[model samples]
Every structure is written in C-alpha cells, then in structure tokens.
Target chain A: MPTLRRDFESRDDLIAHYREQFPEAAAVSDWVSDTRGGRDAAEALLDNVDPVEYGRTRNHLSGAVTRLSPYLRHGVLGLAETRDAALAKVDDPSRAYKLVNELAWRDYYRRVLAEIGDAVWDDREPYKTGLDAEDYADDMPDDVTNAETGNDFVDGSVRELYETGYLHNQQRMKLAAYVVHWRRVRWQAGAAWFLSHLLDGDVASNNLSWQWVASTFSHQPYIFNQENLRQWMGGRFTGDSVGGGSPFRGEYDEIKARIFPRA
Target chain B: MNENARDKAVIWVHDEMLSLSWLGYVRRAAERTEIVGAVFVFDDTWVADERLSLKRLVFMAECLEQMPGVEVRRGDVVQEVSAFAEAHGTTRIVSLASTSPRLRRQGEQLGVDWVCEPPFVELPARIDLKRFSRYWGKAKSRVFRTTEEIMEQA
Candidate 1:
C-alpha cells in the first residue's frame, strides 16, 4: 500500500536513507556478504583496484547494473542525473564509460519498445505460442511454482526475486534464457509475471530483456545449461558441489517435451 | 443551441479509480453545468485482472452514488458515454483527461469537447535530499558494484 520515495540526491546517501527509512529494507541493499569463502558468500572479488586506472570485478559489474534498474523504472530516478553524478565523482573516462554503457542498455530497451510497438510478441520464432500460459496457467509452472526445478541456482534466484523485488543483471538474463530457450516458455508470459511482481519492473526493460533472452528479436539465441546457471546465480541451493545432485538434473528430452512439446 | 445556456447538461467520462482531485473536477463541473450523467468505463482486461480489490470498486460505487444526475455505466467507457450522450441529449461532453489514450482518442474521434485537468495533489517541489538519496543510491548501485557492499559494510 505504501509507495517508495520518489527522489534522491547521490548514490551513497540514498543507500543510507533507504536503510534508515525502511527497517525491512536493510537486507535489500546488501549485495555481497561481509564473510567470504563459501559460494553463497556474496563477497565481490575485485580483479584489481585502481582508482586512477579503474578495474572490473564480477561483483562490481552485476551489483551496479541490477541496483539502478528498480529506481529508474519507478521514475524515482533519472538516467541523465545519475550519469552526471558519476562523472562528477570520478575523473576517469574509462570507468565512467563502462558505467554509462550499462545505462545506455536500459535506454536502448526503452527505445526498442517505443519503436517496435509490441511486434516482438508477433514474431514467435523459437517458442511455441500459448504453451507457457497453458503450462504455468495464471502463475509459473509447477516445477518452478512448486520450487522443485531441482536446480538450486534456479530456485535461489526465484527466491531472491520473491523476497526482494530484485535480481542481478546476469542472473535475470540467465533465468529468462533458461525459461525461453531451454524451458521453451513464451517470453511475454514470463515478462508479464515479472511486471506484476517486481517493484522495479519497467515495461520497456522487462519485455525487451525477455525478448532478447528468448532470442525472439535477437540474432543469436542462447541456452544456459547447469554450469552457466550455477555460476551466475550465486551457487547451488543444496550446499553440495556446483551442479551436484539433481538440482540441475532434468533431462533435455524431458525439458524439451514439457517446454516445447511435439507439435 | 445557445452557447451560454443557464441549464447545461454535462457528462464526465473516465476510467476506474477516481483520484481525490478527479472528484474535485466532478464537483466543479457540477457547479457550472447540470451533471446529467457520469459514466465510469470498466475495460475488459482490467476486469480480468481479478487483482483489482473490492475496496476500489466499493469506493467507485460510492463516488458515483454521491454525484447528482450521475449515470454509472459498466463496459466500454466510450460506447457508454456516446450512448448516454445521445439518450440524454448532452450539448457538450465534459471529461477529465486522466482517461486512457484509447478512450481519449475514441472521445476525440467522436467529436466531444475535452478539458484536461492538471494534477490535483500539487505537493511542493522542494529539493528533497532524502528522496534524492534513495533514487540516487538506486541509480549508483546499478553500476556501482561496491555501492551496495560498501554501504552494507558502512
């Protein structure tokens, strides 16, 4: 019933303000764990740190892109203002360039929706239309709905989305790919559910991103197996080795049948 | 048809969930012109959502009951308004611009005069540091990888 505040000054101040404003929101901002060593430990490992040179780390990259999507979607934040702020903080053009590229991707998807006008749904190259809607019904499929996908990585990401209206950029893309390319569900179906649930869900970004993953609009389609899914979605859920147990163990034939059944 | 008639019948056509400010439009319009009929359009898809709570419907029903000479129509807002206009012989159609583009376009296409009302709740636009921080944090955190962890650590 309550709405999130619609304005903010700088990044650091906003984080602190959100923590102070909402008690439950404390966990919302925590991307990586202070404790490390375990796969679940969210320690963002920096490949190298050079303020002068600017470095890339897996943690930094995923964390940065995912965090802003929610705010920008809600109209609480503007892309231009954020970009200007970054430029003000650091003089390094390379660092600013990398960050700006991420923002451009967000804008790119918006422009795609504005220009294409929902033609993305009409294409239906790989996915069987109306199949996912039938399988998932009003919600997601039982395997996903029942949380018995046996894939810890899949389950963990789903849990993260349910708990916080957030997911890392890489994880979200992988999830969409798994659903569309591997699971063979319609991208819009998945996108619709995301829009209803995700607090930060933006129509342009969510719909186009799902299309991009489904390979409906994209030139290249991608299928994420257990290994790729495991790596991106923190680690597996069962505390066993990555891809251990039946977590990511559904047969391809079975998946194909369930997702893209014999026409 | 005299342009300046003392007793003019005005009809308000709009979507569901009437805001407080929207209600104000009804009050003011009613004062100026005789509010003969008010039609609230229940679009097909919105009805299907099933997620729209009972409270909202009750609130709308209550609002409709309060207005004088207000006629509440259930499906296809534009159609309802057009039919009501013809039946009641409404001289000039009065509508709030908060309605959807489809409805707005349909209204325009039907050759009805429209009046766009500005936002009712004009909260002062003071530079809110707290608000700025929240959105700013969200924006920075997107690419500010350490932004979350660094803040969490702090």
Candidate 2:
C-alpha cells in the first residue's frame, strides 16, 4: 500500500498524478471532467437549484438538472442533506416534491443494493423483450464504444458519455435502449461501460436503470422515437438520420415492432 | 467522555462520507469519543477489477483533495485501512455508514465503527423494492415530510 500525495499546483497537475499512478485507466482514456468534486462545488450547485423549473424541464437535455449527482453519488452530500437543501430552496415543500421524490430513487436503489449485494451485476429478471439473455451480445460494439456509430443521436451520446463522464438521464435511457434493443447488446455491457466513465456511477442506480431499459427489471422495455430524442435534446443534436443510416427514425410503435419482433 | 479515548480512534473516510459534516458523527455502537484523523483508501480491487477510467479516478482524487487532513492511500481496502490504523497506533476505525457491500465487508474485517447518517425517510422494517412506483407508494407520504416531522408523528 502506498500513500498518495494530496498537494497540487493545478487541476492539470492532479490529473497528471492520476495518469502516472493509474496507467491502465489512463490507457483506457485520458479524459478529465470539468465537474470539480467538493462540498463548495456541491453547495454552489445546490444554491442554484430551481425545483419548479426542475419539475417542468428535467427531461430536456439542457433543463435544470441540478448536476448534483456526482456529489451525491460520492456521499459528499447525503440524501437527507440534499433533500433538505432542495426543500429549503422553495417556499413550499410541494415545489421540492419532484426533487425529493427523485432522491427517494437513490435511497430505494441503495436499499435494493444492500439486499441483493453483488447481484447488482446480475440480471434481476428475464428480459421482457421476448429475447433470452443468451440472445444478446455480451460485448458492446466497437462503433458504439469508439463513437463511430454514424447515427448522430447515438454517436453524440457515446461521445458525451466518454468525454464528459456524464450524460443527461434522457440520453442515458436512450443510449441504453440503443444498445440493448437496437444493437441487441446485453444491458450489462452498457452498464459496465457507463460505470467505468460516469463520475456519478453507482452500481445500483446504473445497473438497475440499465435493466429497466433492457426490460429485465421492468414490465416493458424502454424505447423512444427520434422525435422524443429530438424534443428532449433541445436541438443540441438532431436525433435525425445523419446520412439515412439511423435506426431511430421511426415512431414508438414502429420502433417496438422493429426491435422487439419476437415480443 | 475523556478525549483520550479518541487518541486511539481514526475515522476511515470512504467515498460515501466525504462531507466534513459526516466527520462529526461518531460511529454508532461506540462510546462518545473524538476521532484523531481520517484516511481515504482507493480500493485497489475496484480500480483494477472494475477497470475504473482515468476520468473517474481524477474526479475522485479532486474530491479527496478538497477534504483537508484526510490521508490518501491506494491498495486493498481492508489491508490498507488496517495498516493505516496500526500506523496511527490504534485498532479503532470509525466511518460513516455506507450501504456498499464491498465497504461493509471490509468494515467487518477491520471492525470499523459505522456512524449512521439520518435516513431520508422512515419506512417499515419490510417494504417492497420490486419497483420504484411500489416503493414510492410507501415512501412518498413520508418523503415530503422531514425526518424530524416523521419522528414526531411516530
């Protein structure tokens, strides 16, 4: 066991230290996130939380997201503390309802994690897509991993996840669907990739959420049409066919029919 | 409570309890004793086995750097923590409670004292976790209320 040096001249210095210390991870990707981790950064984000706006606009990519998950995921801020902070932001408690309810999701997942332990990596239930576990690809496709998918929405999402180590919840779900449903890859592959990169990645939240999109832990598989992606993206990415090669161009029913042909 | 009791106690700072506020919580099941220092171990197993990316490591290191006076170590969590405690001339290792089984297992091996943070909401000893809606059905009523309000109601 070796003690790590804490003093740093700058963020670049700190990143270099990590690159040297964990060469394998650096070899995986030398990316660094702009999201600094600390209580000061956490509280600053907390102070700007608009519960009303969050409720109205959270589904959108550019919405009032609170960007507090990295702090929350690391236990830099406890669930109760964050809930109280959100409540204190609003005059009425109900205005904080959506934010608090979402906190309950983390709490719920944690409880599930405690109960199930390492089984978080296992499929909790059978896929609802009428596809067996063996039917899906075990490894993620290199194009999706390398951000060469040629589809704007999926490729953009892959780039975002890799570069920023963060993804909006909508993109997370849509990307999970793109992998599990459209690509016929296993949810575990997507979950593992996400866990490796996401700053806020928790085994329970990441894996179970993957299962939800994969329909292994939900009543139905989660899928969204191009219109849904476009609407929530706030026009950041087209979610359109870049060169007429996107599999996401259809309606919800059409997508379901195409991806889950057996179901 | 004599402060000397904590001259031997050290808080094991995990990723789950990075808040300075959490440092104030003395582990449950321990007598009121001051903690002399804190140590944060980057679990070698997680780093190597999980293949955690540089971005993840960098973000975590940034968080650790922000916390003043936390000794950082990278190795097997249980071994590193045990060695840290021994180097400080103590067997007592206190930490904020975490639901992470990996941490829990290491804590058991080291006999780390765990300080339980306040629950986000109170629930039955047994409740459904099969689905969010089902869990929320029970959680929503209490969730809107503060932990204090719920305790008062109870």
Candidate 3:
C-alpha cells in the first residue's frame, strides 16, 4: 500500500488525518497532539536547563524536571548534545550530575537492549516477589486504562498520561508498581500499554524500567502506600478536592498486608 | 572520498536520527559524492503497528519539513529505498549507524553505507553491560569532560 502523503495545516489536522487514515490506531488516544518537533524546539528545551534545581526536586510533580525525553528518544537531540547543553549552563558540570546520570540510565538501557536483544521482552530474571512470572495476568485491566481504578493518584496519572503523553518519573514508578504488585498484572502488559501511549517510549527503557518495578530486574518489587501519595501529591488528586477518598490511604503495614495477604 | 563519484550518491535519513548530527554526515557526503537527494521512508509495517501513534508521525513530519528535498515515501523499507536509489541511477546509499535491531537489519538488507557517529560516552568493547554504574565508571572521563576541553583538543 502506498504511504499517505499530505500537509497538515495545524496539529489537529495531522491528528485528524492520522485517525482517519489509520482507524486501527483509534484505541490509542491522540491526547498529545501538540508535541512540537524539530531541532529548534529541542534546543530551546535544552537551553532552559536548571540542572541544580532538577537534582533537588525531580521527584515531585511540580519539580524542575527537564521534559526532554521525547526529543532524546526521537534523536532530535543526542545525549552528547544534551550533556554538553547542561554543562554549558552550569558553572560546574557536577551540578548537572543527577541529570547526566538520568541520561546515562537511558544509554545504559539501550546498551542492555543491544546486548540482550529480544530477551528484553521477557523476564530478565525470575520475579523476586512471591508471585510466579506466569501467574501474573498478561493483559491490563480495562478499569485501569479507563482511569477508573478508584485510586485517585493512579487514575490521575493515567489521565495525565492519556492527555499529555507524559508523566512525572515518580508517578510512572508508582503506576508500574500498582500494575505489577497491586493489580497482579504482568509487567510486560503494563510496558506494552505504556509504549502504546507514551510519546517518549522506547522498547529498551520502558520495558526494562517496568521489569525493574516488577522485580524481574531489581532486588525487590516496588510497592507504595496511601501516605506516600498524599505526601507527594497533597490534595491534587486525593483529599476533599476530588471527594473520592484516596484508595491508597492506609499505613504501610496495612498496605503490605492487603496487597500481599499470602505473604 | 571520490569527489566526482560522490556527486551521484543517495542519502537516506531515517526518522530515528533527524538532528544536525545526521545532517553533518549528509553535508560531508554531499561534498564527496553525487547528492541525488535525501529520502525518509515511513515503513508500512511500523504504520500498521498499533503502538505507532499519531504524535510520533506528526513529529517526524515536522522534522522532515525542515530538510530540503527530503522525499517521504511509504512502503517496505528495502524495496522503497532500493527503488529510489535505482530511479536516481545510483547504487550508493548512505545512512547513520543505529543500535536498533530493526534499523540494523534494514541497513543490511538495503546494503547501504553506514556512518558511525561518536557515542555520548565510549565504553570498552568487552565491558560488562549488565549495570549502568560499571559502564558509567569506564566512560566517566570522556563523558564528563567540558565541551571547551573537547573543542580545544579537537
């Protein structure tokens, strides 16, 4: 079949054209329709670097995180170029160490993919949790995808991901944990779901990070409690603002007992 | 680099690497080989994959708009690239080296000239690839050096 070629007057036009041209991809939302491309935008993002603040508050939802992954993933900006950009902005390159380390993690995952190849799609090691790899569900639950997980924090993150094609790093970790540990879904399923929606998604980074959360690549499976969400997110999703009491509201021990009753 | 022969070469710019780094190769290649034109092929297999979202396609389209004379075609990679090169009467095809298995396989199938760009950080050929810390330690000196130092050395 011939590839469709046409000019988009605006981003909405491009999105409309894509939806009409490829109806099969309709299940995946075009929420991130305004993503700018090209070298200039990438450079502008790089130029506005705050490596010092990024180190201190990158974990928070309102952190000084550099939203440069989509550009980096697409190779509009190379890792070396981003590193040099960071170094140029700072008086000392060490100030940019946290940011550089994050970038290196991306490179590390790529190298891992290069070495392991198709194995990345499989469990790198057996699950560390009590659960068996085969025991986990191969598909993500529709409730989770529909942002009706009943947990405000998780649902909010899912909504953000669908709307913006981006999520805070900490939010991703929590969501991945919720999928693997709480919902008893396989990390591969979650990874695939994420890859379909994420603008910055790559097979290597996304899958490996999911594997890490699933404890197939890490020492322990990551799990979170209600207090952790409240502390970081405050009343943004949980509390009186949403009127839906936090599903995650519980003590750590209670959460552990509830999610891992067998243990 | 045969100056006269280069005038007839074809440059294939993949969507994965759209930065000036790839452009540098195109410009340098154009200097030595015949610059038939640059081509970006949107592989049908990828388009058909549900995982390939509209955002990525739009992003690629925007990138392509910046490059002059970059023909955007849709078809099987090998056939489209080969037909384009053949149409231009040039067997020579140039592309940036990529770590993606798919891209590497495509390169082999196309029998194109691959150009290796300098990595962000260079690691030893046989280093343990299991962990980032190990790889980062070996590459620290090279990666952490100031741009001015690199430029001065160059």
Q: Pick by DockQ: which candidate is best?
A: 2
Q: Tens-digit lDDT track for model 1 on A1-263? A: 11223233543444444344333323322321211111111112121223223325433223333244443442223454345455555656456656555565664554344344545345434433324334433335667644467666567777676555566776677677666655656677678656544544555677767766665555545454554454544543332333566323455555444545543
> Can you write out model 3's per-residue Cα lDDT over A101-178, one digit (the tens) per residue?
898888888888878877888999888777787789989999999988666677788888877778888889989998
**Tens digit of per-residue lDDT, candidate 2, span A1-263:** 28998999998999999899999898777788888888888889988999889998999988999899999999888888788777877888999888898889899999999899999889899999988999999999999999887888888888888788999999999999989999999999999989988999889889989998998889999988877778899888777656665688777888888888898
Which candidate leads in lDDT?
2
i-RMS, each model, one decimal: 17.3, 1.1, 2.3
Ranking by lDDT: 2, 3, 1
List clashing residue pairs in candidate 3.
Answer: A226-A248, B6-B33, B6-B34, B7-B33, B7-B34, B8-B34
Reference A-B contact fraction recovered by candidate 3: 0.52
Proportion of the native interface contacts kept in model 1:
0.00
RMSD for each of the candidates: 15.4, 2.2, 3.0
Tens digit of per-residue lDDT, candidate 1, span B41-105: 54434433322222223223333333333455555555666666666666556665422334446
lDDT of 2 by residue, B10-89 (tens): 88988787777676655333456546678998887888776788998888888887888889999888888888777777
lDDT of 3 by residue, B96-126 (tens): 7776777778888988788765467765687
- RMSD of model 3 against the true structure: 3.0
Q: What are the DockQ scores of the candidates, in order?
A: 0.03, 0.76, 0.52
Flag regions of model 1 displaced more than 4 Å.
A1-55, A58-66, A124-139, A234-263, B1-154
